[model samples]
Target: MNEFQPITVSRRSSREEREIALMQIYRQVLERVPYSYERKAMAKAERDFLSDKIGVRRFLKELGHSRVYLDSFYYSSANLKFLELCFKHFMGRAPLNRDEIRDYCDILMKQGVHHVITAILDSEEYRKVFGCFTVPYARQTKYYESPKAYLESDILNHEHVAQRGRAVPTLYWHQLGLNCEGGVCITIEGENPALQNYHPEMKEAEAPQGTRIQQELLELLHGLDAVEAQRLVASLHRKQDRA
Candidate 1:
């Protein structure tokens, strides 16, 4: 008679494996550890079966339900800003145009923030591009460049720079012969009459129309030789007069 042998195969339950996967995805997508608010929200979501069978939509909805998300993003000052953040965080790109921003803003206002988030997460575009398990990443190629390039490029903007608690000092503007006050830039002294007028304290005489044109020409053709630039300016003046 042969002795019966018992086979032992080790395997995690599907539900347990799913929970582990969900936790990992949450860490990736959220880009941070679970704070107290997030922990509480996640617990509630788990109880509600949202985190159990996690899809992008359910995951984002759970995040949106958190106090941190509501306080940080939903209550941001501007709807456009909030929409922009949603694109950056969820779709990993900037909004394509004003129409897209407006449409999403309308969704946010009408459907609430969580619905706005879910709509984005469940969108055909998101599903086609990112799928269920893939983590979202910045789609703008420029973002991969140096931090200075990212900050100065149109992708981040002044509002985003300020929101990140990093100071993009006005020294850059000063170096470029500009003076910034209250976020408005004015040309430094002797730059241009139009820009000079912007500085009320300068007390400089208003330049003649031709002088202003010449100043603009000088600025535009700064890289050219002075004689060539002057000739070009004179040619432009002649053409303007003929017109």
Candidate 2:
């Protein structure tokens, strides 16, 4: 009787390796890049490019040309803001100081946005720390001790904050029947006659529609258990009957 031996193979074909590399690049670009809009379209485009075997530098350049990038970062934002975006998207770090900002801004002004992006990706610093396979992460420095502090700093000014605030289309404040500032003045004129009485502590005109007793009962029963709620209701009913 011959003994059966198990064989183990640990190797991937060139095509398989290339596919894996492309998928990795896609993930890194998608995850690291900060596109404000058209995320789904951008992801699809990256996948398509991977299928076509487009190199990383070209992939990054293509991402930079995206509508979201063009509208938000490239065309709209200032040179300094663009440099900051490049740092966040490529190196996963905030610019340490004014000099660093100036140096990048100089590059952007001289070579252009695409060249600046390519330079960052091809930098010896980036290559040494995060190779092609590894995803770049934020390199924490002493300038901003923590993420909270970093966000609070002048680096993230109100202009940047306001730029990110997109107007929600489906959110109709007018449909809520609110005034211009989302406030409504309650008046007794069109309200139910039974609800005209004001709370004792409140100003007569500013009082709620419902009586104090009804308000108290509602507050009491708001989060009660079944037994407790029933008991409270029965007690209130008894008190009403006695009155």
Candidate 3:
């Protein structure tokens, strides 16, 4: 891609506006990019593009935050379009089809949700409520097979869904729900001794240590640019080899 290839994206409209856009893209990417080959190649490409467009420090920072509240931003249509444009700029050609690009962008919005949620789960804040069960797989893969299974046939493609049930499940009693800026607040902190006592053992295990969604996204910018960077490095090595 030309270094100076001029591309246009919608200017920053608002915080919510941008977040909404991110969500939309995330959803699109999830649908389009499935299976091992596409997943690996796309992840590599995304990582490369992100590093090149955004510096590593900034990218990691974004990922760190994404570990927790990824859904807050993903699942929005507007953000997905912006992300697609970003991907286009990163790769010279349109590497992702329109739908594929859209879906991946949505997935990228969740860069660091795992880390943040893990931290919160460990915190004293919700120890009582979260003491039972384990956070379910945030991302899960399921295989499909037919009755006519040939030994040589590669198992058909798989399906994936964001795991809704956390490792622990919470039971809520019907008390007056509090209406706050945050969603439903059903607990009175420190007052619920019975609830705390009833809770089960809280596990402190960690999720995979890596980029949360946003961080992955930020890294993706750099990764995209790095493709050219590596090419430059390789070309330099080639010249040195010739010399």
Candidate 4:
């Protein structure tokens, strides 16, 4: 196995960007750890078996036996901001791997949890810049699958509308933009507005529910001690905000 490498980030990036990279790195380390899939599956099956063998009320009580499994899957989450920042510094991007992408499904099987990853990777916010890499859904859309689908009318014009409504907020990726001693600069352009608008409707028609969950998630990131909250907020897309 390849030994882990250290990354030297540019001094010019903003404090926020640095923080995000750090948080993402923390997430990357967590991703490398192993979880017990067989144990969880066996336990779940046992619960069901017991439920079938016993009465409903008895099974209900037994179900509480797996509270740890439920908590880790449904409630527990690792902080990825440090991991994101580390990737930004070393590779200048986020790591896109099967283990990284599919771990959530391994941990949990709920519909809502599945949608969170889909929205971030599939949304225009991601597609606009890095372009789409994987389509997790059965019904893939053209915009997500093809960058050419983004017409001038869709993003530019819609940006005007979003700006008018104060709905779409601009994000600066400059290394030193938000929190830095000064001197470094880098900017990233994201998905156009028109296509971005369609993202929410196509996925859920409500908003990015993942972000709301993230607000609580931020509180749970315990291991990383040196990072700040603003940095993670910057990396996150404002899915819940109204347009």
The C-alpha TM-scores of every prediction are 0.49, 0.42, 0.16, 0.19
Q: Between 1 and 3, whose TM-score is larger?
A: 1
What does candidate 1's lDDT look like per residue over 1-243, in tens digits? 445321111232355655554564454445456677667756766554433445544656677667666666555323444566666667766565444655775677677777778888888988876776555655444333455445333433333322332111221332334444443444455453442332223322565443443354344334425565455334332121111
Tens digits of per-residue lDDT for model 4, 29-65? 2222224653364355434433333322222123222
The CA lDDT at 132 in model 3 is: 22
Q: Over the full model, what C-alpha lDDT does candidate 4 score relative to the true structure? A: 0.30
Best first by lDDT, ranked: 1, 2, 4, 3
lDDT of 2 by residue, 142-203 (tens): 56655544642333222232232211000111111111121211222343332333243664
Highest TM-score model number: 1
Please estimate how well model 1 matches the true structure, expressed as its whole-model Cα lDDT: 0.49
TM-score of the candidate numbered 1?
0.49
Order of models, best TM-score first = 1, 2, 4, 3
Give the winner by lDDT: 1 or 2.
1
Alpha carbon lDDT at 188, candidate 4? 24
Best by lDDT: 1
The local lDDT score (0 to 100) that residue 92 gets in candidate 4 is 27
Q: What TM-score quantifies how close candidate 3 is to the native fold? A: 0.16
